[model samples]
Target: MTFGGTVLPEWKQRDTRPGAHPLRQSGHGQRFGGPCVKGLWRRAVVVGLALTVAACGRGGVDAKRIAAADGAEWLTYGRTYDEQRFSPLAQVNKDTVGKLGVAWWAEFDTDRGQEATPLVADGVLYTTTAWSKVYAFDARTGKQLWKYDPKVPGEAGFNACCDVVNRGVALWKGRLYVGTIDGRLIALDARTGAVAWDVQTTDRTKPYTITGAPRVVKGKVLIGNGGAEYGVRGYVSAYDADSGKLAWRFYTTPNPKGAPDGAASDRVFRDKASATWSDGVWKESGGGGTVWDAITYDPKLDLVFIGVGNGAPWNHKLRSGGKGDNLFLSSIVALRPETGEYVWHYQTTPGESWDYTATQHIMLADLNIGGVERRVVMQAPKNGFFYVLDARTGALISADKYVPVDWAERIDLSTGRPVEAPSARYRDGGISQQASSPLGGHNWQPMAFSPREGLVYVPAMRNRGFYADALGFKFIPGAWNTGLTRAQAGPNTPSPKPATPPLATGELIAWDPVARKARWTLALPAAWTSGVLATEGGLVFHAAGNAFTAYDANDGKALWSYDAGANVIAPATTYAIDGEQYVALMVGVGGAPMGGDQPRRPGRLLVFKLGGTVKPPPYPAAVAMPPLDLAAATPSKGDADRGAALFGQFCGACHRIGGLLPVLPRSPAILDGEGFKAIVLDGALKANGMAPFRRYFDEAGAEDIRAFLLWQAKQPAPAPKPGGASHG
Candidate 1:
């Protein structure tokens, strides 16, 4: 998620995302119009009339100008400076939220995922699509206003770890700012979509990419890079909003000369550098720290907070000497917004070896803890701990295990350290099973904080994984490995066997931050990925797998539930216009490591509203399969019989012959005959984990396999079984 950063755990070099562009700002120099006047006597008469109207509340100074006293419009990244992902407008209260529906939706004219939250202001919604192209639309009607493409290089896709989606843009003064995937930040004129200024955040030749939205605070535009998975050092920087001049830079990890060279404030990083990181690990691991998450700011405290991502290579022994806190690797940092000076920091995981990054949520709130009122920074790190710390001083008030975790027994409150397990640390050549899995207890989708409910709701998954050592670990181009066993498949490969775990259902937990306890919990049939959103009407909205539901925030009562018919993986948001409220979210099942494995077909975006009758959207167009020549293989009765016998012998472990089924790499429906032939005949199948069928079957034997496959496909879909059967 971070830009210009190295990959985790092992510090192996990685390729960066392309399309991240440079940013700039525009000022209020043009006077469009103002009040008109005549002579003093005439002005006096007009003033008297104005005073009368003002007294009636119709002619007072516009309150829109007053609201700007803090910050104008949610133009940057994730709404406002704090990135709370919460809106102050209460017009769309729970009472009337049932009427929420899509006024209109812009499909963006592309199949790229809609990960970006639209920046709304001045009746226009500004946002970026996949590959970092910016677009503006009339907020009320979803009419296209303007679109700007940064022309990111084509090869940039190779550097992206996930899909080529941009989270959003930042707005300052009258200009729009965005970071491209290919290591540049650009600023555009809000009125015309014209480029004003652009700057390179880093050299793309090093394989860095930018997917995070740039944040704007005061008069500075701030941004971070992502490539920790690609082995790049991470940093956060500020630039003059109007001129794009570099203001200051803060590197996440300590470097040679102790601090950044040639800066007055560099001395602050002295002495503490070596204390936080072990010797030789920095040079070997490349100090992986990518701050891909959005930054939050509190004007009252004059502080900015950012959630830092996990370390590189994801195998800690290779990154550290089994010692050192690794400085700020998996920590939330508090710094002076104006000076970029580090005030204090709380590391979520010290000497983190399990890729459990503390970089998920950054929620700011005022709570009463232990009879004392305190301003706090709250987070549910991937490591499975819920931490509540004093916002001003970084003092740990409470730390609790929020999920099924065995890596650490408890957090020592006095010393702020974890009670580690002997096998928790990864051994270079030994295999170990760790609880809370590499997915952590949670991932980056984001959680919701309801001030009224005094609760935080998170979509949680419980998983377990095993890590085994691999030899000759080095950064290789176009290669991805954590210096660990491939597939987490089993203790061995090639002659591999399936191992099962106690898979559990996903849960929606409503946590009381003040009490530090779960008020209530509800379990789902499958893993949940969407975050929760609470409204003034006392309803909490969330989606998991194929279901989207609303619950009473007071208790975990399900108020309304709907089978959305698709997996809801992205986070959700709400907004209102012209006294009517609306709820918006994107739902689909394809992207990343999980996408290819998920079963849902057809991606979609569904908008729901109460009392409003709207027809469902048409499904995505079906892809056409190319023609296949099966006759070229030449099949005889003997060959067919032999192929079927061979399939039964080698693939029957995971494949079922009837009710009937085919032994295909993917689902039977996703492939045609030709596709199946290529997979069986070419070695590409085995290269990516699917075993090679040609090893034991001849051309004639392959015909028998094809016959069975066709017969399976032509059979009617199976009836719903009363009891679910497990398949490995």
Candidate 2:
């Protein structure tokens, strides 16, 4: 039989034929056409066949298909190249949303954060879990089809600045590409969950990791790494989809040694970026500009844009002797996807000392500006500013503060830089409090754009940080490289006694980009809320605290909500199966800022549709920590200062004075040396997601930690300040 000019061998004839067509044969088949065709004919036929296969393999997510997604499927990370994350599906509209309930829920093994946005195509749902694990399920029924675990090393968890979380995976050509936390990019056979090819994208020895999802453009899988806090240079690399060979790499920062690294970024760095640096100490610590998140591809313009991270040793004074714009540190750069050539860049935070990363979310759209329709790229970066730029020419169209900010009064449209406040730099050895902490006005939580409403939905944060220089800055081998001390940044300190505290708050703001004003704002109980998803149903979905709530997209009126029983930090996605629309999101909260004191429950993927009848499990009750009697107990007699250092190194990552996990100072077990030894050395809490530190701590070391906890328990808590820093 002939199908689309390609011969399909008959079953009976295949057994009798001596040399059957390679496509019909078993065991490692040859390229589509058989050896029967030769020379020019073979080449032409193969090219044609390849194009056909490519079109089919795109599986409802090709450029044309995504542009016209029509709400039946979610093909790409943002549902389209524009990354608007808005769905046209209205099956569960405002009137019917009140009837929405859980359609199905799938629990994951790891309890770490689940920050992925699932991709639905051809009735299959694809998502990633903690530690870069991928899973596929039936979109309608929620039956697990297959699961793939890259088995990333347990120790690699330390390299991740946040918890061991993976944002998502990319689907292309019948394959799913995922970047493991240990810096490896693996492509899997989408149907069988089998490994297709694996390539290490970063140096295993360095503190580099890949928590962000991969994006595919022009038959190339592009991936970037994280670890700016751990002191590593950052770059984004593209690999051939079929062969897993390196195609090109674009480094975000320049070589520290005043020499070219012979990379795609060399020419641009030397010509445009080198002058922005003062050299010296920055060369030792690779200038941190990790492109951990936010890669968008514009097929119409044929350009790929990446949001670059903050600088290493966050204090610009320490990192670069308090000078230079530090080109590309906090910027959005456009590049040629095929050859990785530089196009143009707009630095969001020049001399980014406050950890104001430009790597938040990038959305593309055509908006009427000054009565003229302009192609624009929009972003609300960490510095608390909403910016609109010419997507084609990289020109600043307009920018305004989307949230409260003191670091800079406003963005200067003429120079494309911020008009810094007098005390914003904090270079005189005095503490400077600034709005929009290191966590940013927005973090990795994605924002959504609605062309129908002409508004951008932002998960806006109101937070601040106190920045003070660490007098004698020293780089730790594999620890956080911020030149500011932990306590000075304001939240990662140990407190023994209780104190009244000012709270940080978050809000969902619908802002008109052209007008630079918010249409409406819905205040959340807590700061650091989840991302937003707007639907044609006249409803917007967002996860705050323990509920997934739907609000009227235009008026911000509460429409409906479901208790997810777990804190959610990932964005919600919508798709349709068999003419029915379903809204899906991952539920788990364990990132840096939301870690301590926040609930630590099992991760779950919850799906909902109108009139669905599945009920979610009840939320776990808060665990009350037992009272401590450290004064009545025998002292461990260890060096309290040494113990304090150890606690900061080991326990500070997850534990806080009043967080989701038990507060160390108030825990009775830590007050008792033997009890501490049992939990830390005997792995008593290993089953509950705590790692056994037996390999790193001995009996004496455990007692030292106990001593520190005892000392901390006796001290008075510092006065809580509003808008204090909280890592995300």
TM-score of each: 0.74, 0.86
lDDT of 2 by residue, 1-728 (tens): 44456564332122233433211222222222322222223223222433443345355345555554545678789988889998866657676788787899999887777889999876789999987899999988999999999988676776777777898988886788999988999999888789999999998878899989899898899999999877898899999998999999999887877788777899998788888988545677788899999999988899999999999978899888889999889999999999899999999999989889988889999898899989889999989989999999899988998889988898889999889999888664556677777777888899999776888999988876667666677776566677765551112443222122324778899999988999999888767678889987677899787778999888999999878776788999997654357899998875223323334577899998766898877756666434567667767777666666566655765566523345677667775677778788887775454556776668877787777777777777654433322434
Off by over 4 Å in 1: 1-82, 88-97, 256-260, 263-265, 279-281, 488-505, 525-528, 561-566, 589-611, 621-728
User: Lowest summed lDDT over 10 consecutive residues: which window, candidate 2?
Assistant: 22-31
Cα deviation in Å at residue 579, candidate 2?
1.4
Task: Please list the residue runs of candidate 2 whose C-alpha ends up more than 4 Å from where it truly belongs after superposition.
Answer: 1-61, 488-503, 590-600, 629-634, 642-651, 658-663, 666-706, 716-728
TM-score of 1: 0.74
Q: What are the per-residue Cα lDDT tens digits for candidate 1 across 34-130?
A: 2221222221222232233223322212222222311112334444444555443333334444444445654544443445655655556677776
Best by lDDT: 2
Task: Name the lDDT of candidate 2.
Answer: 0.78
